[model samples]
Target chain A: MIPAKFDYIKASSLGEALTLLQEHGDEAKILSGGHSLIPSMKLRLATPSVLIDIGGISEMNTITEEGDEIVIGANCTHHQIATSDLVREHVNILSQAALCIGDIQVRNRGTLGGSLAHADPASDYPATVLACEATIVAEGKDGKRTIGANDFFQALFLTALQDDEIITAIRFPKVSQGTYQKFFQSASRFAVVGVAAIKKGDGVQIGVTGVSGVPFRATAVENAYDGTSSAAKHAMDGVDDIISDHFADEEYRSHLARVYVKRALEAL
Target chain B: MNISITINGKLVTHDIEPRISLSHFLREHLDLTGTHIGCDTSGCGACTVTLDGQAVKSCTVLAVQADGSEVTTIEGMAQGDQMHPIQEAFREHHGLQCGFCTPGMVMTAADILKNNPNPTEEEIRHGLEGNFCRCTGYHNIVKSIQHAAEQMKA
Candidate 1:
């Protein structure tokens, strides 16, 4: 099916992209790798007046190492991240999660930032990033501001980013070890229950996906781990309050969450 | 926009709408109908093509995005009048029945072989996860890929 007609602007630099966003306001949508946005446009779920293609912005496509964090440019494709030597050495969980996203074709075109910005509850990256306690950098008329992963994802298909802002990069703190475990729905490859666990010096963080409107942390499981109880069972215990629906009932998703959390913790 | 791309070893330029999908560009614009579009949603993998030496779903990519890239379609896989080893193996092993998914299946298999010259049966199955066949002929497809791998190695 053909998408609705809209003006296309290929921005060569970040400044040009941001200016276009400011001018178009909510009527503009930024296109990165076009893995997420293009499909939505084709389906008519999104009909923006202007499409600002930012894939050519070279500055937004690099993966760099800062003091104690790894900064991944928003436009970095999943294929690039999954095969990066730096990611493999420093943050393997992201690479592991990237490998499981859709299939090879989707991985070649999907970008890390687009996935996070799209804020799909079933996506694998949000939970992994939340578990790693990453920060998102958003650039707009107000300049730059960083939002924690937990604060970044506000609701289903929603983010803390303003309509006129563009996500520039994401920063992940260096962790000793981390792993992501996902149970994908067969056809769409969306997570039925995805878990990401990170081992920081003396603490562990657990993030659960495909079980709620937005990816959330399993605080009870973390608390249980701190108290020397079984982390997975405790995480499952906290599932009573989580929202549920047709894709996966509360009971089944809870059970899968426990199973995945245990597996992720074990792998970590 | 007038976009120029090297497709299947041929340099072609087309002025088309930005919304035109690469799959449509190859099939409708260039008349290289070997690349089929099974599902416009990018699920079927029937529109797979090598964009800049990397396999991507053509349905998901815009023609403008591939302007500066080299694309290898199923039409480009064969040499002169001879079939590629994968194609020959498929024919020998009866990898296709209806032939609807043949081009994409061959292209995806070629990509896997390019990366892994010797893939186990399970590896071949996992590599073809993106491509689907309604005839349930995956068993023979695996054999054909294995046979082609051996032929290429020889």
Candidate 2:
């Protein structure tokens, strides 16, 4: 299926991308890997007048290590993340989550920055990123600022990013014993309920996806971690306003969330 | 918009609408009908192609986005009368029944072998999940990839 007609502009660098975004305002949509945006465009769910193509911007296509954090450019594809040694060393949970996203084809072309920016409720990155306590960097007319993973996702298919803002990179802090476990939906392979558990010293952080309007850190589960299955099932006891869809009712989703959280914590 | 791409080791340029997907550009414009479009939403990997040596769903990629990139489709796998080792293995193992998903299967299998030359049956099965086959029950498909992996090693 062909998407509706739109002017495509390739940004030569980060500077050009920022300028184009500022000029076009809300009429322009930043195109990274185009996995999410192109599909929505074809379905007529999104019809932006202009597409600021940032896929070829070499500046925003890297994964590097600086001190204790791993900095990944926004254009870093899931395939890149999955195979990257730096990612494996710093935050293996992100790579594990990246591997579980869709299939090999999707992983090759889907970008981490794009996924986080799109903020799909079922995406794999948010859970791991949030669990790692990552920070997302954005560039706009006002220069640069970092948004914590906790405040990044606002709702389903929504983020805290402004219309003119573009995600530059995501920073994941190195942690000990991190893992992700997901119960996948049959056809799409999207997470039915995915949980990421990260262990840093005596403290454990947990994030849950596909059960809420947005990906959220399961604070109740994290705080209630007593290292037992009995305590794990009650992780969702206070997680109200769970999303209900055709694939799963709210009750089932909540149930899956707790089960997956227990499994993730066990793996960690 | 005018964009140029390297398809099957050939450089081609076109002045077309920005909306045309890489899958559509390959099939309609370049007449490389071997790349099939099953589910245009990137679910079915029928339109799978190697963009810069990585397998990607072409339907979810704009042709304009492929500018200055190299794309290897099913047409590039074989050399004239000589079929690629993957194709030979598929034929020998009875990997395909309908043959509708063969191109994508071969393409994805090629990528898997590229990444991991010798993959287990579980790995091959996991690799083929993106490219769906309604026929053969996937037993032969797994065999085909395993066979191809051995052949490539030889």
Candidate 3:
């Protein structure tokens, strides 16, 4: 499936990418891993006239430690994160979630920033990032800023990222214990219902995806946590707009959400 | 866009449109038809190829993205007349029925073995989740990979 005709510019650096983005404005689309973007373009869902390939930007491809947080570059592939010892030690839920995304071939090329920026409701990272309270770092011609995971995902296939801004890194706080449980949708391997649970002292934070139009932190489940799986029942207490498709209807998706949430919490 | 790529140890350059996918480039431009395209979408791994040591679905990757990268398709597997151990295993174990998904399965198997030289049955099954064989010959495919792993290890 061929995508629409477009001019491809391989940016040598982050600044060049930003300049190209601003110059092209609405006509441009940032090509990171291109796993999501390229497919969308092939389907004619996205027909940007200019593609600013940011794969050459070396600065946005590293994983580092910054004080209390493990800063992961946006361009880091899912395979890289899944195998990173630092990520495994600090925030293992991110690693677990990364391992659950797509498949080996997909994980080898797909980027975390691309996935988060695409903001697919069934994507695995959103739940992990929300559970970890990760911070997404964005850069643009104006400057740089960070958006917490809670505020990053706005709607289905929508993010808080501006047109010209690029996600450079994601900062995840150090967590000792966490787990990700996902019921895959078979063909695409996207989450039918994915739940990420983080154990913090006496409390827990839950993040759910694939059950609604927007991936969200399950504050109700967290609030109802009594050190037992019984709290998983509240997984859909406030999560309306439940997605129903041929893969799963609303009732089954909700049941899977609750089941996966319980599994994640029990695993923690 | 002008792009250069190393395919099966041969560096080739082409000035093509930016919309051409790596799978299309390999099949159309280079005439390397070993990399089949079952589902134009990324769901099917029939277009699987190694881009700089990583197994990726070539259909989803733009040809321009592969500039200056080393790509290994199924056609690159054999050495002279002697087939690669994995390919030989497939032939010996009768791993393929229709042979449509063989290239992708072989390439993905190579990647799986490269990463884990001694993968168990469960690991091989897990690694092969991307490639689909409509012929339902997965049992032999798994066996072929196990035999190939042993052959490569020895």
Candidate 4:
């Protein structure tokens, strides 16, 4: 399927991409892996006049250790993250979540920054980032700013990024223990209900996605934790906007969230 | 827009629109029809190809996005008259029925075996989760890849 006719410019660096984004405003869209945007474009859901291809930005493709956190470039592919030994050692749940996203072909081309920027409610990284207390870094004409994962995702297909800004990297705190449990949609391999639980000292940080319009940290469940499985009961305590599709109804998704939360807690 | 891609070890340049997908570029521009387009939505793995040595759904990849990258389609798998080991195994083990999905299956199989030279039956099945085979119920397809792994190892 061909997308709508649009101008394409390959940005070799981050500064060029930012400038292009500023030049086009909302008419231009940043192209990363193009797994999501291209498909949307082909379906005519997104018809940008120009595509700023940032797939060649080498600076935004490195995985490094910055003090206490593991800094992952926004352009890092799912296959890179899923197979990275550094990610496997620290912030392992991110790796776990990365592996659960789509299939091998999709993983080879999809990017972390692109996925988070797209902010699909069923996306895997949102759950992991929220649960791990990761920070998302966005750069614009002014400078770079970090937004906590809690405030990054605004709504379905919406993020805290401005039209002129692009995600440069995601910073995740090193965690020794974490688990991501997901009930997948059979055809697309998207999460029907995905719950990520990270053990933090005496408490657990729980993030839930695919059950609601916005991926959120399950604070009620974390607050209710007392070293037992009973805390998983509050998985949906404060969540109101539940998604109901043919793959999973609201009630079924709610049930799966609690069940997966319990399973994640048990695994932790 | 103008883009140059090393497809099947041959550098091909084209002046095309940005919306043209790599699958269309390979089929129409280069006349390399071995890469089949079963599902344009990236659901079925019929359009799988190796972009810089990694298997990706060509339908999801724009022709412009693959500029300066090395892409290997199913047409590049064989050496002249000799079929690739994976193709030979598929023929020997009856891996295909209608053969519409063969090109994609072969390309994905090459990637699978490339990553894991000695993959178990379960591993082969997991690696092939992206590719679909309605015929053979994947019984013979799995057997073909399993046999291919052994042949490649030896």
Candidate 5:
């Protein structure tokens, strides 16, 4: 499947990427690992006139600590996140989710920033990020600003990113206990229904993905959680609009959401 | 656009379209047909290859994206007709059927062995999740990788 012809530029810096994006307006798409974008392009589902290849911007790839948060560069691949000692120590749930993203090949090339920016409803990171209350930083011609995970994901593949914006980094506070559980789609390896649950301070936080048009925090499930299966059974009490796919019907997806939530919460 | 990359330890550059996938570039332009392509959507890992020492699906990567990096395809595994140990193990264990998925399986297995010189059956299976083989039911593939691990360790 050949992607449509388009002009390509490898940005040497974040500034260059932003400038190219600003100049091209809505016609420019930023390329990170190309794991997500390239596949979409090959399908002809996306036809951007210009490809701003940001994969070469080495400065945007780092995992570090700042104050109380663990900062991860957007260009950091799933394999990096899955194997990073800092990520494993700081937020094990993120590593666990990264580990299960696809097979070894996918993990080696898929980028965290790209995954979050692409904002696929079936993607794994949004669930853990929403559960952990991570902050996403977006940089543009003006400056950089942070978006809460809950607000970052809008719907489907939609995000709050402006055409010129680029995700620079995502930061998460150190967490002691967290887990991601999912029923996977065999072929794409995407989640059929996934849950990320974390014990944060006095309460349990949970996020549900692949069962909605967007990945969302299941506050109802979090409040109903009592370390028991009954709480998970009632997880969908307040949530509406469960998604159905060829792989699983709505009823099954809802059921898996509750089942996985139970397993994740119980694991935590 | 123009890009340069090292494949099989040889440096090559070309003026190419931005849309050309790495799998196509390797097979068509470089004639390294040992790297196969199946389900270019990243589902089938038949196009697996080493990029900077990490296995990635060539179908999911652009030739332009691989610029300035080192790539290792199945063709690069052997030296002067001496098959790579993993290749030898595959033959000895009858690791392949139809042979469409061998190049990719071997590449991914190379990556697994590089990270974990000796892996348990479960680990080998886990590492092979991306590389699908519709034949052999994966029993012999696992055995082949197990044998390769022992041979590499020896």
Candidate 6:
């Protein structure tokens, strides 16, 4: 099936892309790798009037280390992050999650920024990022501002990013150890139930995906495990309100969440 | 819009609509029909190609987004009349039956082998989570990739 007609403009720089977005506002969509947007466009689910291709901006494709955090440009492909030495060293769980995103092809073309901006509830990186407590940097006509991972994903396919704002980069703090486990749906390969756990000092932050509108922390489980190993065992005692529709129902996902949370905690 | 790209080691330029996918640009514009378009949605990997040395679903990529990039398709995998090792292994191991998903499967496997020279059988299965083959039940495809990995390592 062919997509609806649209105008395409390849912007060479961020300023140029921002100007295009400011001009078109919600009517204009930024095309990075187009792994998520183009497919939706082909299905007529998202038909924008103008597509500003920001893929040519070299600055948006970099992965760098800044002091205590790793700053990844929004355009960095899953392949880039999965194979980067720095990411493997400091945040290996992110790389592990990146490697499990899709098939070889999807990882090569899909960008971290694009995935985060799309904010799919089942996306792998969102839970990993949320577990790592990453920060999303957004730029627009009003300049740049940072949003915490907790507040970044607002709803399903929704983000705190303004209509004219573009996600510039995502910054992740260094952690001692982290692990991501995903139960992928057979057909789409999205996370039917994914758990990302990070060991920070004396506590653990557990992020759950594919069971909610947005990737959210399993605070009930966190509170349970606050200072004991029994926390891992009894993590899913009170998180019944988080699960939703998809490949698995609330009961099954809750069960998987309990299993994965225990496994993730044991691994850490 | 006018876009110039390096496809399968050759430089080609074309005028395309903003909505024209890279898969269509290759099949329709350049006539490189080896890259099959199985699903218009990105769920299927039948339109897989190597973009800048990494496998990507061409159906999900816009031609304009591929500007200044290098693309390699199944047609570029072989040299002259010789089939690529992965293609040869697929034929020997009976990796395909209907052949509709062969090209994309081979390309996706080739990309996986390039990254993981010694992938485990489990890794091979997990790596191919994106590309689906309705035929063969994936037993022989796994064997084909395992054989190709050994051959490539040799």
TM per candidate comes to 0.95, 0.98, 0.99, 0.99, 0.98, 0.94
Per-residue lDDT for B1-154 in model 6, tens only?
8888998789988888978889999999888998898887888788889888878889988888888789999999999899999999999999998888888889889888988999999999888877888774599999999999999999
lDDT of 3 by residue, B59-100 (tens): 999999999999999989999899999999999999999999
Estimate, for each residue in A100-151, the C-alpha lDDT of model 1 and write its tens digit.
Answer: 9988788878999989989888899988898999999999998999999889
Candidate closer to the true structure by TM-score (higher is better), 5 or 6: 5
Clashes of each: 0, 0, 0, 0, 0, 1
List, residue by residue over A46-123, the lDDT tens digit for candidate 5.
Answer: 999899988888888999988778999999999999999999998889999999898899898889999999988899
Task: For candidate 6, give the lDDT of residue B81.
Answer: 95
Clashing residue pairs, backbone N/CA/C < 3 A, model 1:
none
- TM-score (C-alpha, index-matched) for candidate 1: 0.95
For residues B29-118, what per-residue lDDT tens digits would candidate 2 score against the true structure? 989999999988999888999999989889988888899899999999999999999999999999999989889999999999999998
Question: What is the Cα root-mean-square deviation between model 3 and the actual structure?
Answer: 0.8
The TM-score between candidate 5 and the true structure equals 0.98
Q: Lowest lDDT 10-mer window, candidate 2 chain A?
A: A226-235
Who wins the lDDT comparison? 3
By descending lDDT, how would the candidates be arranged? 3, 4, 5, 2, 1, 6
Interface RMSD of each: 1.0, 0.8, 0.7, 0.8, 0.8, 1.1
Checking candidate 5 for backbone clashes, the offending pairs are none
Candidate 2 Cα errors over 4 Å, as ranges = none
The ten-residue window of minimal lDDT in model 1 chain A covers: A236-245
lDDT of 5 at A207: 87
Q: What does DockQ come to for candidate 2? A: 0.87
Model 1: runs farther than 4 Å from truth?
A226-229, A236-247
Task: Estimate, for each residue in A102-200, the C-alpha lDDT of model 2 and write its tens digit.
Answer: 999999888999999998888888988889999999998899999999999987798999987899999999876898999999889999898988987
> In model 5, which runs have C-alpha deviations exceeding 4 angstroms?
A227-229
Q: After superposition, how far is residue B29 of candidate 3 from its true place, in Å?
A: 0.8
Candidate 3: misplaced stretches above 4 Å?
none
TM-score of chain A of each: 0.95, 0.97, 0.99, 0.99, 0.97, 0.95
What lDDT score goes with residue A76 in model 6? Answer: 93
Q: What is the DockQ of the complex in model 1?
A: 0.72
Query: Cα-based RMSD of the predictions, in order?
Result: 1.8, 1.1, 0.8, 0.9, 1.1, 1.9
Candidates 2 and 3, the one with greater DockQ: 2
